[model samples]
Every structure is written in C-alpha cells, then in structure tokens.
Target: MRFVAMCSAPAPLDQAAIRVRHTLMLLALLWDADRARVDLAHELRLSRSATGNIVNELLAAGLVQEVGQREDGSVGRRATLLRLKACAAALLAVDLGASHARMDLLDLRCRTLGTRTVAHDITRGPGATYSLLAGLLEQLLLETRIDRSQIALLGIGVPGPVDHDTGCVVQPPNMPGWDSENIAAELGRLVALPVLVDNDANLGALAESRFGAHAGLSDLIYIKVATGIGAGILLGGQLHRGVRGGAGEIGHISINEQGPVGRSGNPGSLESYAAAQVVPALAAQLRATGLQTRLPDPASLQDLLTHAAHDPLARAVWETTGHHVGVAVSTVLNLFNPQAVVIGGRLALAGEVFLDAVRASAVGRTMHINAARAHIALGTLGAEVGVLGAGAMMVDHLLTPRGLPLLYSIARRAGQPVAEATPLAQDAASRAPPAVSAVYTPHPSPPRSHPYSPRRNT
Candidate 1:
C-alpha cells in the first residue's frame, strides 16, 4: 500500500502554493542585492531544489534574468547572479491631475524610459481625457521605440477618491466631470490594456515609501498640496483606506467652522486656504497693499517660490500657506503618529521655505509625544511620484498570492508556454507538490463591455 501511494501522481498545485512561491521569489529579488540560486534558497528558507524550481519558473516568465557569475572569491565554479529583467515587460503609468496629464513609460524595474506631460483641464470629462491619453500612449511608444506588444499593464492615478476594487473615481471635488466614472473600463477600452486606478495622493505615499529618500519606512504619511490638498496614509506598511476609501481626504477636514467653503462644500477646509490655486490670489491681495517686494504683480505659484527667499512679500505668502497646511498636518500627526510626514505635489516645489513653515506650525500644535516622534520632510521623487507609485502598486499586485496566475498568463502570452516552460507546470495538476494541498479557484475580472484587445499599430 505504501509503495502504491508513493507512486501515485501528486495533485495539482493549489492557488495558495503557487502564489506563495511566486510572491516569495519576486519579493526576494525586489529587495535583495545580486542574488544567486543559493542566496535565494537561503533567503527563502526553501530547499535548493524548490528554490531552483521557483527561479526557473521566474526566468521562463521573463521576469528575471541570470546576469553574470557572482564574484565571492569562491574556490571552484562561481554561481550565476540573478536579477529582475528590467526590460522583460513594459508598464505605463499615468498621473491625471486637475490641470495636467502626465504619462510615464516604465520598465518592470519601475525605471522611467520616457515621460511626457500635457496641460489639460480634467473638467472636460472622461471621454476627452481618454482620447488625449491614447494619443499620449502612441507618442510615448514612438519616442521610446518600444513595441506595444511588450506592454504588460497600465496604472493611473487620479486627483480624487477611488474605489480601488472597481477602479472608479468617486465624487472627486477637483474632477468636476469624472464623478462615479469607471476610469479603468473607459480608459481600458481606449488602450486595450489591463488598467488599475488609485488616488494620486495614495500613489504619492506609496512612491515615497518605496522609492523616496525614506524608502522602506513602514509607517508614513504623504501629503499632496496642489490645486487640492489630500493625504495618503500608510500604517504598518499598508494603505489604511477607510471603509469608503476616503481615509485620507484631509483636504475636507474642517479647521474652522466659519471659514469660506471650497469645492467640496467643506467650510474652513485646508484646501480653501493652502491649495496652489490660492497662492496666486493671495499674492495678488498682498501686492494690492503696495508692499514693496520683488514679486511680480499677480504672482504665480512659481513666482512666489522664486522670490520666497529674497522678497518679503513672497515669504509672507508662503508663511501663510505653510501655516494653513501645517495646522492640518498637525491633526494628522496626532491622530496617526506616523514615522514621517512626506510633503509632495506641485506646491512642494517651494522647497525649504514651504517645508520650514509647515514643520514649525505642525510641530507647534502637535502633542509633545507625537511631535517628538514624527519627522516631517519633503518628497524626493518630485513630479514623477504619482506615476512611480502607480507603477509600484501594479508591481505589488502582480506579485500577490492571487495575482501569480494572471502573471503567468501574461508571461504565456508574451511567448512562454506555461506547461512546457515551467518545471512544475507540465504535470502540476496531477503532480502537486506535497506542500500544495489547498484547492485552487480562479477569480477572473468581471466581463467588461470593452474587453481587452491589443490596440497596437503594426
């Protein structure tokens, strides 16, 4: 009986095991440096054979490549070094702000190969936006000289609250015509690609945490102060999206009940005072007072920052703007006690003057313990943060336990045969590994009105 049982073919690998192996391998490469087969095996605490199987599958999927031999001054044969194939698959990241649309073509390593930004009003609605995006995508491909077939995924960051599960923008105050629009479905139809959407501030937070100067900090807050103010909250290394995905709508948080109302109909909101739009008007008011300063009449946000150091009037305006932002940030610090508060967005370009005022006001108002622990700083990625964040999010999703099958499917489409290319894929259904006993069930995306069909020009 024992011999018969031992000789019987094993069951197929369950969803859990496939995901575990794929995620472990991808994440191990993502963080580690100059990995070899032996290094991964030790890192994952898996047997050499199991690790090799996972590495082989990754290689077949074109997600990783054997770079060169590791030089550890070994006695005999040196192990081949393995690294993520940055050019294995292309990803497009779009950052749609209230007044600008920015697109970046990134490789699997999240390195930007080409980037373009165009001025466009979001209030024009989704149809116009999609058309513009399609043109931009074509232009990006042409500029980078990359074939569209190599593209794997598209990620978008919008200036609004997003229902991530459905990729819909929900009642965003800045985006007048985009309320409740299914961004992913509409945009996916235009480009014929798998699309993921998230709030711009959320992406900024993710970018700062993963790729900024303070990379790897688990708990951080990314505050975006632009045409509108918002925050992305990361607690314990995960996004703390509220029940309705409105957790970081800090712009609407009321500082004074009697203050003037803004777009969101929130009285005394942070956005009402400190948004980038307010800077121009505020500067106008100061100039009207005949305050002798180098600032131009009706100064732009850029002008304000340019003269902030030398001009007294510019300093006053920034001080005021930063104070408003800082007051709101103080509340966040006290409530969340994050490790760092990273300021980003268009207005953050003001640099030290803006950051100093924010730090002063926030630290002054925050509770002693919270103030002591939280370090407020400017973001390092600049205007590219949103797109980078979106790319990072997509990468993370594709490596999740539920995402391995989709990744494998994408790899298969890119020319690798799942059954023949991967070691266990051939007889996985009948030769399940001993550790993979759980049942596997795939949850496909809901059928779309406009199903994905590559829209590439031959």
Candidate 2:
C-alpha cells in the first residue's frame, strides 16, 4: 500500500488546546491496565504543568476521569490512573475498495460496535459506489443506533490515488468515474458528519505504525500487493505522505518499456503484472482452455497463490511478478533504508516463492546497508487491515481536531470552528521529559499534484 499526502491550507486552531487534546487521545491509545499519570507525562515528554492542564481540560470535557492510583511498590505515594470515559463520543470509519465497502462504529476505547459491508463492483463507476456506500452507511447508522449528534467524526479509506483537498478517488484504476470528485463532501450531505479521507494504502501504513504490526518501528514500509500495488511509508512515527496523493504509487513504476500497458499506463507497471485483476481470468484460460498447465482452473486469489506454490505455470507467473516487485521496492529500500518492509495484500498469499524471489533480487540490486538492515516480511494483519486502518483514521481525525468544522459528516455534531482556537504555548511549562515528537520536526508536504496518465512516458 502507498501512503500519499495532499497539501491543504492549514486549519486555524487554538494550538494549545489542540495539543492537549491530541496528546490526551494519543495517551488513551497507549493507555492500558498499567496506566499512570506520571507515565503519561513522561511518555508525552510534557512538563507537569502542561500535562496537568491537558488532563484537566479532558476532565472538564467529561472525556476522561481519574480511575485510581498505581502501586509503585516503593516508599512513594501512589500515582493516579487516568483513562477515557468509554461513552464520551462515537466515530465512524469507512473503507471503500475495488470489490467491497464497509462502515464501522467505534467508541472512545477503540471498540467496534457495529459493522456493515456490501459486495459491489466499485470499479464499474463512482456514482454507484457512492450509492452502495451510502446504503451500507445507513445500515451501520441504524444498527449502531448512534444519533447524528453523538457521531464524533468520519474517516474514509479508498483505493487508488486520493485527492487531498476533495477526499475522493483521484485516479483509481479498477474503480472508474471517481476522478476529481469530493466524495467526503457528497457523503456529508447524506449523513451530516465530519469526515476525513485518505488512500487505503496510506491508512494501512498508519494503522500498522499506530496500532498494528509495525508499531514501535519509527521508519518502516508497508506494501500491499493484492488487486493493486502500493506502499505506505512511516517515518519517525508519522506517516510519510507525498505532496500529491500519489507518493507511494509503486504500481505505476514500469518494469519493462515493451510490456503490456498498465491500468495507469506507465507500461509494465507492477499492478498490471502482479495484481489479481488478471489472475482469475488467466487461471481460467489456463485451466478451461486446456492451455497445458498443471494447475486446474483456479478462481480466487487463494487458488492462484496455492497453485503457484506448486504449479509450474503459476510458479513462472509469480516469479515474473516478483522480479517487478523487487525492481520497484529496491528503489524505495535504497532511498529510505527503513528498518522493515512489511508486505501484504492478496498477491502476498503467493508466499515464499514470491517473497524469496523479490528478496534475492532486491538484495542483489540495492545497497548492502539497505538490504541487510531492512527485513522484507509479510504483514500479519491480514485482510481485516483495511477496515482496521479506516478505524484508526477516524480516531486520528477526532484526536487532531482543527478549529473549523469540516464538511465530511455534515449531519454530525459541529466542532467549534478553528478560527478562534489558541496555541499550546499559552500553557505554563512543565519539568517533565518529552517524547520523540515533542519538538515537532517538520517534513515538507508537496503541492497538490494529480496522478494522471501522462500523455507519454518521460
């Protein structure tokens, strides 16, 4: 999966308030039975005074409460425990993919209440996808019984390139008729809630970094090699999204100049060769058409992958695709030199043959430091990752609130506009040590560039 970011005009905020709120939410995610206020202060690297102010604000908002004290097992007063009020608010997460769309309801503790999924060919068109998504959303809303007023925020993850400003599919290959549309805004009118949109691959990466497999790894790559190909990059704990929404468009990297044109047309793009988009049909041809392959007619992605593990023709196809994957991933490894590359998606089911081939080729082509330092491994999150990532996105948007109320879930509650917000510097300083991001080092997010099919290759 790829992690692409869009450039947007900064939202006005009460910087101090946002910081406190954001820090509290992060603490909530990191909180557990061993929770302690001092630990919170230490983990966030905030001064006692600053952490106190934040905790107080959350307490006043009725979002948090002091549960009890932690026994230090030493000759010291017990430290008080703080945690989220389970019923504080609700969130909605949407995952729109090539084959299916789902909506989930989550509480403050990151518990899922209700989920609804629909099986529709989203790639046929965007309008249809929207309608189907709307229906599932309605069902989720009804099933969860969450009032529009109780809904805190909405987070959406979609396949293909995302338009940062509009929050829709910019140039998805499988899904058609989604270009330059503000899907978040359109769905807002139907549900009336605040919404945040991001590419699925990017969300997958963030999910891993925040709560999934790649957690605690500051710099890592999460690659999705299913119906499509993309990568998600996490640097210093924050997701690395490019200026435009196509930063990790690894699938479009042409492997051979003279090969078949890809979905996004860069000739021999990774998806064109690696994705399951063509595998089922190809499997059918080989099995039904009596093309002389050892493997019988394999229908699903699993079937192909299983066959490839032993079938000669399937093995050849997998090896060929692995070469392309290594060619593309080696560049990323060389450039970023992340400590790990976690590969996922339907195609990843092809297993050891694909992984071994890609790894061998990548090791041969890339710097020894890059190859040796970063372990190329399969993700353990599996198929549910997209939905889980979508949930994380929702939690993120809720935690990092801006002053202005967004247009995502229009029928949802109104957050005070960001224009009248204040910064965290207004709070008194604390003596506590800070965490890694306390200084907030900046990475340049590029301009809003679209990933369109260029008239010709460079």
Candidate 3:
C-alpha cells in the first residue's frame, strides 16, 4: 500500500496557525530562489501586513533568511529578497531495493550532501536490513560531519508494500520474513527521528512530479521496471494510494494466461514478462528453442541491450517485452487518463528501442481520446530518483499545516524550540482550508493476496 506522511487537520480553533505556517512553507519551497515579500503576498493572496507577519515568524524560527534586496527598475524602494535556509536542517533518505540499498543525506531543500549505495538483500529480513541501513546512515553522518541532532526526519523507500502509518512491511511477495515488521519504529529508534515509509515506485513518482521531467504536471504515472514492476500514480495533483494503498499494482495485471507465474502466484502477470528478471529467463527460453543469436544464453538486460545493436533476436525480445508493457500501460491510460506516463528503472535504460515499442503499442491499443492526451516519456532523475523522491516526500510532509506543528515539536526535541506566535487575523483564519490528513495508518486486516482485486469505490 502507498504511505502518506501528513496527519489530518486539527479543530478549527487550531487551524489558523496551521494554515498561516503551511502557506509560508509552501511559498518558501516553491520559490526556491530568493523572492520578495510583495511577491509572496501576491502569491498567497494575503494582505502585505499579514504576509509580513508570517515571514517575520518564519525568520524568527530560523526557517527563512532575507538575502540582500531585489533592485527593481523603479526608484521607489528596493524589496528585500527572502529564501528558505536550505542548510538549516537535514533529512535522511533510504531507498531499499531487492538486491541493493541507496542512502542519502539531504539538506532542507532536498539537495544531496552525500550519497552511498551498497549491495544487500531484502529477503535477509528486517533486522539485518535495518542494521545495514543504520550502519550506512551512521557512516554518512560521519563522512558529512552532520550531527545526529541536525537530522529532522527520515524517509525510506522500500521495494515492498508498506503499512504507511506503522511503517510495517505487509506481506510483500518479494520480501519474505518482512511481514508486519515495523520498519519505521525500528529505524526511528536507531536514529532518534520520526520516520516515513512508502513504496519505492511511489517515491519515484513523487520525485518526478516535483523535480524531474514532469515537474509541473499534476496528473501523471511513473512506472518502474526493474527486478520487479510497479507504478506510482498521481491524480488531481495528489498521490492516489487507493483505499488500501494498493492503487498502482499494475505489475500483477494478467496479460498472457499461458505465460510464467509471478511471485504473486499469478500467471502471465506483467512483472513476469517485463521485469529485469524476465530478460534473462526469456533469453534462456529462446536459446532452448535453438534461436541463433549473438546474445548470451542467459544474459542480463544490459547485455541484451548491448547485443541488440547486432542481434535481431535480442532486439525482438525487447520489442516484445515493450509491447507487453504497453498493453498494461494502455489499460492504465484508459483508467486514469494521466497527463503523462513516465517510464523508469533498469529496463528503461535500454533506450528508445524499448520506449518506442512501448509507446507504439500503448497508443495503438488505447482509445484515441485518452491516448492523444497522454505524453509518454522517460524519467530524467536516473539512479538517484528513488532517494530524491523519498527526501522530497519527507520535506513535503514536514511543510504541511499539520506538519508545521510536528516540525516545531521536532525542533523542541532538538533543543531549539520555536516561540509560539499569535494566530492569523480573523478573516484570514476564516479563509483557511480544512485539514487533509495523508499520514499512513495501520490497516484493519493483513494485506490481501495477489493478484489483488481492489473494489472500485464509485
């Protein structure tokens, strides 16, 4: 299931402060570069006096800094330029995969200060995995000379489904012995910080939505085709995790009834056909059929892509796999009608030969109305996407209205408590939006068996 990290809104009496803080943080984040108080006031649609009050509070809290002044052409007055203190705090991001893990230390602006990748196995279970990650995190802190107290939060991207609220791995097919393991709590204990967990693909989607090729789009999908297949869905400018956080398990969708079964015990699943594991297996199957080719008998997806330049058989396999993936994507297009479909992961490294095939097939199969509107493209973030996404998710959560209070609480723990301030003006308070909770919570039952058939909430 997909995990979100923000809590539901509190009572109306408490919302004014939350809304004012939330708006200030969002403006600071999106503005990225230095902006003027007048611009922030205009963007937030608040009076100059109100905007200045919020800015003053953020400045007092060490969240924002005024750097120099904006010299407009007019001779009237120079506007002071304000920007977020990008280095004020740090975040820890972990991308846990089936065969490897990537850890990164990022500043408040989600800029990487240090990163390291290590080979590991998730099937080794949570204890071993958590220990390995903790060690890696400690190493990073040492290398970067970042104090433990400087870390504000932790974001983790697991290959398997997670119980977002509890940070538990929930009956993941690829990760044995991980079921019901409270990953967040365990890691939080080690690092002494609140932790957020989510599917790796979902994190990738979030990263791409905020900073990658599809940065401005609200409706998009990120499909990661690696050792396994997964999709990250963004709809209506927000991540849609479904009722149970299983909203984007397109890999389990059956395409060929006679094809090989997947970990979900489903035959002809998309993952069984398009994942990195499938390339080698499909090669072996082709070789057994006495197919003449320069491609190795059992080749990695990388090896096949290299040979595809000279081997018709290797190119054919990629083409066929891409077509199969496209069929699944076509179904997604028909359903979600996203503005864009971004293809990522190891297999996507095969380049246009593979992407072209996916696009051609998906366009051919999808209805013209949906197909015409969706732009298919490759992901731009490369190997760092997952970690960046995780970091971005954490940052986004911490900047929310409810998250602001949590941030203050974290600051208190860090021995840098921010002083309380008066609430916003009555009219501004009345205009505050209701709280929308996105934080993960425990599910009532264990994750359902795959191929999971979600009941569509109409």
Candidate 4:
C-alpha cells in the first residue's frame, strides 16, 4: 500500500523520458476520466507542445485514447479529451487473513471484474492455503473470461509480518508454520505473474488513502482490530515500514508489564488486552460478576456484539476494550500527529458504540493540539478494504516508470522476464521527441526536523 518515490540525480534523456511517462500515468489515474489537453499541460506543468507530443505517444502505445473534444467557453478552439484505457490490462489481487481468503480480478482502474471469498485457515500451512488460492484464482479467471495473458500483475495482503524485499512471512505469531514461506514466489509460480505482497493493515491504509474516506490525505493511520490488532501508518504520503517491515505493530506493544503473556510471548500486549480472543474471557468475567445475564458465556466476539444490543454488561465490555484501543491510538496520534485515524476490521463492526468509546478515550489522553487536528472514524470500505488495497498496490507498481516495461514484458511472455525489457522501455521513451525537453521534477522531500503540518482533507 505504500509507495516509494523514485528520486535520482540528473540522468540521461532515457531516464527523463521514463519520469515523464510515470507522471502522465499518475495524472491519468488521478483524473479517472477524460481530461482536456490544456488541463493535462497545466497539471503536469509542461508546455502545450510537450503535452501534445506525450499524449500522442500514449495514444500510439494504446495506453490512452482521445475521447472526442471538450468545448470550453474560452475563445480558443476546442480541446481534445484524453483518458486512460482502463481495460487495456488487468490485475489479480488477494487478501489472505487468519481465517479466510478473498481473491479478486481487477482492471487497471482497480474495478473488480470478478471476485470470490472462501473460509480457510492459515494454520493449515502455506501449501494448503496456496493450493486453495490457486484454485480460486483459476476459477475467477474462468468466470470472468479474462485471458491469463492479460493479467499484468498480482498483489496479495497477508495478516502477518512480511519481508518486503522477498515477500516471505517472518515468524508470524498467529499463523503457525508460515515462517519463512516465500508466498510471492509460490503464488507467482502458480499463476505465472509478477507478484507483490504486503501486510494487510498496510494495504488497508493504502486503500483508504486512495479510495476510501481519507482519499488524497498525506498523513493518516489505519488501525485494524480483529483476531489481532495492527496499525497501518502513512506519513508524508508514503507507507512507513520499519527496518523489518514491522513499523505499526501496535498490537504487540507492551501496555502492561504485569498483563498476561500473548502468543508472541509478550506480556500485557495490546492484542492480549483487547483483541477478539479476549472477548469470551471478558464475557465470562462479566457473568461471574452477576451482571445482567447473557445466554451463557459469550462464545465469540460475534456473540458479544449480538448481546451488546440488549445487555448492559456486554456493552460495558466493548467500551472497556475500546478504551484500551483508544489509549494505544492516542499514543500514535501524539507521535505521528496524523490528520485522520481510520478504525477497521471485525471489531469495528460493533459500530458507533465501540468507536465512540475509542474517540473519547483517545481525545482525552492526547494533547489538545494533536487531538484537535485528528479525525477518528470507522472504515468506510468495511470487509472489502483489504482486497481493494491489494488491487491498488498492483496498480501503483505497474504504473510506475520502471514497472511499465515489466508489465509489458509480462504480458508479452506470459509473466516470464524479457532480458531486453529495459531497452524496450527506453526505446519507447526515446520515441517521444516532444518530452525530451519536459524534465521530470520530483516532489520536494518533507523536512526532517519535526512533525509535518496536517494536510487539509480532499
């Protein structure tokens, strides 16, 4: 869900051409519809002649098309409207959670062409899970009548720590027997597509930033509270994976030294105190305290939620859990001072009762200046956020300057690498003579001294 901006010192004409193409792709994606030539020129800060030339190149490549003309009120002649050919390529996206998997086939615009969800367990090990995934993908492709050759990329999100460079699971405490499994490699082999993998929370944050409530925000955090708890952090408009891709592991953060040990062997961790696994225990304690009766002890988080509507005790338990969540989030707000905090996952399904408590506690515990600048809200994407995020991740990668050639090579060779792909990309760039003078200027890097000022929500 995170993107690393490509930055380099002065480069050759070929490299500059790649940057121009990258900028055009970004503009097309953001515009989402036909845009006039003048608007494109203004947005990219390129001269009209340069914009026209680049647009012509894109038109020749079949990546973009002229969709008639825009009759503006200006005295000048009508302007041609250009839009991205969203259906020119497709991507496969998967969301692998602790107890279920969701797969989707999406077009370049991240629109779902087909999708399937199955209940499965990660505890069954990588082999079983992957086999299921392969079968589901095959079925989805068949159902959608999408040619395998058209699938340009695959993106997956897992509920565990991922070695970002290798796409391997690294000792995920919740997913037994998943350690060291190179999921991307296995999945790539099964589908013969270039694959990318990332943490589910991170993907959720990315999805939110691009398509959900926080779209266009530069600083935000997404907290997932479900079978476990994790945070997806976005700072200065990019994902912040720590040294080991464990930046937002708020669930494992020690909240109380004297608290019970969790699966990670961490005592009094946030997950140990407030995750779904503790719901039954909380229900039992409430029952033992002779509070208003619920059938028997709540067997699951769902039971707790179902009872909360009528049982005061169940509501109190949710409030208490929410407060713990709020405390953890308050710490996050103080440190990152993000513009918004999105609460998601199964726990969030409990609705406003849970979110209200979290908001109250977080605001009360944080500095007024920090709390005042932040807005905490339930995730708008609901259960589909992870899958949507996976799609967005692939779109982000494939549209990049370097990724464009890789995408073409994959399509040409059924996901096999073409040794001359880079050269092909350079050749394409070289053909755009008008862009030779349109140097790509990277976005200015944020200052390193203090927290960034909150960006206005778009």
Candidates' C-alpha lDDT: 0.73, 0.62, 0.72, 0.72
- Tens digit of per-residue lDDT, candidate 3, span 172-262: 8778898888878888887678888888888888777766756656688999988878898887556777765677888888988888899
**Model 4 over residues 1-458: C-alpha lDDT tens digits?**
11222323234548567555545443443334467877767766778887777777666555666778787787877887776655567778898988999988776656667889999988999889888988998898778777777788888888888876566889898889989988878878877877888889998888787667567677889999988788989887667876667789899988788999877889999998888888779778877777776565554677778776567777878888888899999999999999999999988888888888999989999999899989999999887798778876776565545466655554445433211112101122111111001111112223222112223222
Relative to the unseen true structure, what is the C-alpha lDDT of residue 325 in candidate 2, on a scale of 0 to 100? 81
- Compare candidates 1 and 2 on TM-score and give the better one: 1
lDDT of 4: 0.72
Pairs with backbone N, CA or C atoms under 3 Å apart (clashes), candidate 4? none
lDDT of candidate 2 at residue 46, scale 0 to 100: 71
Poorly placed runs, candidate 2 (over 4 Å) = 1-34, 38-54, 75-77, 280-294, 298-300, 306-313, 401-458
Name the lDDT value of residue 326 in candidate 4.
Answer: 93
> In candidate 3, which residue pairs get closer than 3 Å at backbone N, Cα or C atoms, i.e. clash?
1-245, 2-245, 165-440
For model 4, the superposed segments whose C-alpha errors exceed 4 Å read: 1-33, 71-76, 294-296, 408-458
Question: Candidate 3's C-alpha lDDT?
Answer: 0.72
User: Candidate 4: how many backbone clashes?
Assistant: 0
Best by lDDT: 1
What's model 2's overall lDDT?
Answer: 0.62
Better of 2 and 4 by lDDT: 4
